[model samples]
Target: MTATIIHLATPEDTVRLGQDLGLALRKGDLVLLSGDLGAGKSTLARGLIRTIADDRDYEVPSPTFTIVQSYPDLRLPISHVDLYRLSSADEVDELGLDEALMEGAVVVEWPERAEGALARPSLSVALVSDGEGRKALIDGETAALARLQRSLAIREFLAASGLAQAERRYLLGDASARGYETVAAGTEQPLILMNSPFNPGGPVLRDGKTYMQIAHLSQSVSAFVALDRLLSSRNYTVPKIHAGDLENGFLLLEHLGGDGVLDADGAPIIERYEETIRLLANIHQQAWPHEAEVGDGTMHHIHEFDRDAMMIEVELLSDWYVRRISGIELDGVQKAAYVAAWDAVINQLNGCETSLLLRDVHSPNILWRRNEVGIRRVGLIDFQDAMIGPSAYDVASLIFDARVTISPYLQDHLLGVYIHERNSAGSDFDEPDFRKALAIMAAQRNAKILGIFIRLDERDGKSYYLKHLPRIQTYFDRVVRHPALAPVREWCEKAGIFSPES
Candidate 1:
């Protein structure tokens, strides 16, 4: 545990730092507050609670008397605990403070009273009173340390980039190892702080490399910075990189509002989805280079969606999903056939010229700007995983989204619109070949999602992904209906993996 000593010059400094930490806190996290009776432990906890509540003036009364207060009304549930009044360790146990970690993040005052009764917290902040101020000592484990380090660097970056006093607020994050926050400095427009540090994958699983390496997933934020510059220059709706630390993976990007193509019921809106595909066609019309400029005299090379990568991705269906759902394991021959089918399709796509494939082109990554005109109205995010691959791969990603259910009728219509847009641009876009590529990619993508969604549910303790299993099956069925995917269809049918009707 490394100790970080921060000198809080004033009460304002203490609250400001607390707000920054508050944005980083999430469920299954803990923060231990230790201090003397009047060393501002309650003050710091109050700052966190108020910030999360989005009510600066809300009275966060200390839980010294009640021992705990639950703010279930807030967007993120919070449980505030006070160990100051607990005379015995058994009393702390009776309060069941550990349960708070599972439900939401907990902030405890005078946690030393419990001694070894609870698990180690994500952060332990110790306050010591100075003459007129205080000094805070922070300590945590690797994950927590990484977050703290990033927050410290962000504070420094904002200072250097002239957004020093920006009010940092928590924004939504996804299953990926990435985090985002909104920073509003003065009355100026808000900026997004993308915290996507390089997280090295575990042991070498494939060809002396990790899964991330095999998948060509971005390890750092430089790919994003480079792709952002390239797409923005092409008149696309990519966020502008205002300030950044590429090596350390901290970026200050323009905030694209979160108005995605999905409606309130989480279904695809017709006009927005059509516009999104048109934007994709417009992007595919251009000739993009394999190498792109990142910063001063530095260039980044985009990876290709080669046959090996394609096979490895589809293998996820066996590695994670089938293994978990049905306990169905693949033998050597079964695995080989799966690889061969994917290899045939990926090789077929490589025959023609390729375009930059932003691997993630689903609704979650798309933003709809009503005020903007033409293709510029569609804002794209999550391009760090982009590669030079078949343009049809992105088309499949859009129409066969995992989160939003794309019916066969709607999918066909969207596909037709995409083709029309390409033909309107006066390109020799072959419809039949594109359909075959789209079919292959749909199968490839659906296989990945089937495994990925199950992995998230079974291994990661996120059960909500199980709700989309049937939807993924339906899309997977649509994939194999094409003649090019007959082998994969036969394998899946004999395996009896998907649902009957699906």
Candidate 2:
């Protein structure tokens, strides 16, 4: 695949672009930043670092004299290396450049010195200083670059047509999936256009007042239809679908706001956590009285937690990740122990009552609306994976997330609140039993995530998720330590699953 190139028209634009890009960077990434002395290289680097490490006091000077300056305090260790003073490729190798690249995000100033030694970069930002401002040309094979290019191109086209002003630029991309594009608006309201070959779920846009969109038919057509049905029944704050061009997968949706609930930095973490958990409870608790009569009966039952299916998923994890990439051998005893652990989890979940499960209930999937009222006020997104399953499954998924850690105290408190609320509504759910199931579900979920993360990195070449291994392992550790699953915990410990501490 070819890399996308973006034109950064101004100094502010260059810095903004850098800051945006920095949010997507993770450990074990190679970002080659090349530019002349006055090309705003350090300025862009400073902006990128500031986004990741908010303190921003670290002097982002040219690493000419030092050759390499490492910042380990940040979530990902950043090695700012200047190869301007290097004599040859051998000198680059002598500096242990490869070792540094293996561990963290490596920003090379004069990568030409070690052109042959450097691996394929996730992103290569080349900055050129215009007499008036600066232009940034970002090149890379990654999906981020592709999405960035498409978005920049779209914005430029809209600007040239006089339909979009400079102030109303918006860029959206899936950092996890590695696809992105941008949109701009004119005096009239902006329309959501679904033009990507990938992401068939259509796009969303907002005018100055409200969100507008046309719905397009795709693999996720049922999801959109369900969302529309949900809007009618509940007073939830999801984006309203204004128009639809079903054939082309286009949608005009009411724009909620420029920022999502996840973007609220000023809000207290505990407050956000409580609000999010409460919203989840609302969805799980509020059931359609005619759900069985409403549509097709393809939904999996909560009580039907299949040991065979669970074992199959667990074996796939072993085959695709552990055995394939790590080359880890699971002997007869090891295999039997893993299966037993997985079977115990399945049996535990089978006893729970079924509820509406929003499988992907992480931070990114939720949108907090300030104007909405009550616990059900949160805006939900990415519900395509919705299913009927154990209530604790989604709860476990949210609390023991691999990407971000919810505080242990808050997680426990939310569990208490969720169970209390459910019981108050005449549900016969048991708290102690639910907590045990949650621990098992968490272990199963983390195991699946570990496999998925590895597949994304090794198979798809999206290595950004590799850094999340430690966080995922932490979740596994917490789950395995549960007294109810002590047998499973001992087996995992022997297998070195939590060997690498985050």
Candidate 3:
């Protein structure tokens, strides 16, 4: 229902527009290209196709003769259709466009030839010759229109960063609102463009704070940039911040290679996991500052993982996971009991040695730079939500990685590696106290994860997270049996939190 005009000064500019839009695109999208002959529609389509394929020089021949060209091997398989040769609009169905959309996106050139047969949610691009250049009049429904706007915003940000000519390639996006892209200018080293828009911490729940604010989640990219500098200064392998627009939440960061700690078969490589634990041990041994200065001379405070934050997180079990599987909303007394259960566990944390918790030290966030020496071999990312908490929290995060199934034997091996490294380096490392904290943190994290997975399924319409619930439940049962978590164990048993499927 809305329209935006993008001015393209040259054929390359048209291609750049396609590349920008390509980054915003998702599967099942339809792109209608309407333009006169020699209006560069094919050129733009080629750019978009090449970007999805992650290759700058991918071969994209015009579909004039073939009628349709399907690239099935790309990130999202896209079908480029030339409706110019179709004798009738009904022929559009014969081309299997509906089937193509089921798998990926479809781009239709000379859409007028279809005579409105292609009725779907589409981004309409009308190209017109403007002197020697071309202008694109883009219009669409809400989702498609929002995609174009986001793409244009990225273009504006890149232009301001003086990398207007950089080749933009979609890197990855997470469950959060953050997105990342790799932008390389000419033959220069590729850099990561972190697009993290400010999250207006949702409706205030208590004490005039949203869930994000109550839990100390980073509301902006300032935390990431500040933490990157802080960790890098301590000789850790966090991405070096090259440039950033803190106000707008865009950061051009060093592209730490995508070599994760997992092996080729998607299983954890014991060596890399051990090395990562050693790296974490080294990190926990050091005393970190409570606040670090951002590049803009503003202070970024690292919040303490206090009782309110912990209790709020654990309540996710009662609020989402319990209600989802059992359809039983806990009454006020039940919710109060749940809070009381975690109080004892949190109190026990008082005796544990405390340090900074990476909060998300798992397989996905960790990178194994094999060529790098010592602790630098372990590269860290996604530490923006880092908190000042028990040192054992990070160890628990690794030992019981939510994504990877770390067997009991393997978990013991990695935990032993961490304890050995910590005790060898640090003074007064009490093994019993550390073990108790690890158990408490592990149970707490797994409880939060169960509720989060269910919340993602019901609230966000993301069903994929449901598959991980069984794995997390098995891990939760193992840790909740610890003597340190008796109160939590008793509450979970009564609430039927152990039986997620039943």
Clashing pairs in 3: none
Clashing pairs in 1: none
Cα lDDT, all candidates? 0.83, 0.61, 0.88
Worst 10 residues of 2 by lDDT: 209-218
Q: Each prediction's Cα RMSD?
A: 2.3, 10.4, 2.7
Which residue ranges in model 1 land beyond 4 Å of their true spot?
A: 26-28, 54-59, 72-76, 115-122, 140-143, 499-502
The alpha-carbon deviation from the true structure for residue 399 of candidate 1, after best TM-score superposition, in angstroms, is 0.9
lDDT of 2 by residue, 1-502 (tens): 5444456676667666655566556566788888887677777777667655654355676677999888777766788888888878877667766687667677777787786787788788887765566666777766656544544444444444453333322235343332222223442545443233324332443232111111111242334445444544677666665444333333445555444444346332556567777776777776643232112333221222345434554564565556644577677877877777767657766667566665677766666676667765566655534555667878897787666766678678878777777777786668787788788778777877777788777766778788888777677777777776776666666666554223
Q: Please, what are the lDDT tens digits per residue for candidate 1 over residues 392-440?
A: 8899999999888888899999999999998999999888888888888
Which ten-residue region of model 3 has the weakest summed lDDT? 493-502
Q: How close is candidate 3 to the true structure, as a TM-score?
A: 0.92
Q: What's each prediction's TM-score?
A: 0.93, 0.57, 0.92
Global lDDT of model 2: 0.61
Could you say which candidate leads in TM-score?
Answer: 1
Candidate 2: Cα lDDT at 345? 53
Cand. 1 TM to true fold: 0.93
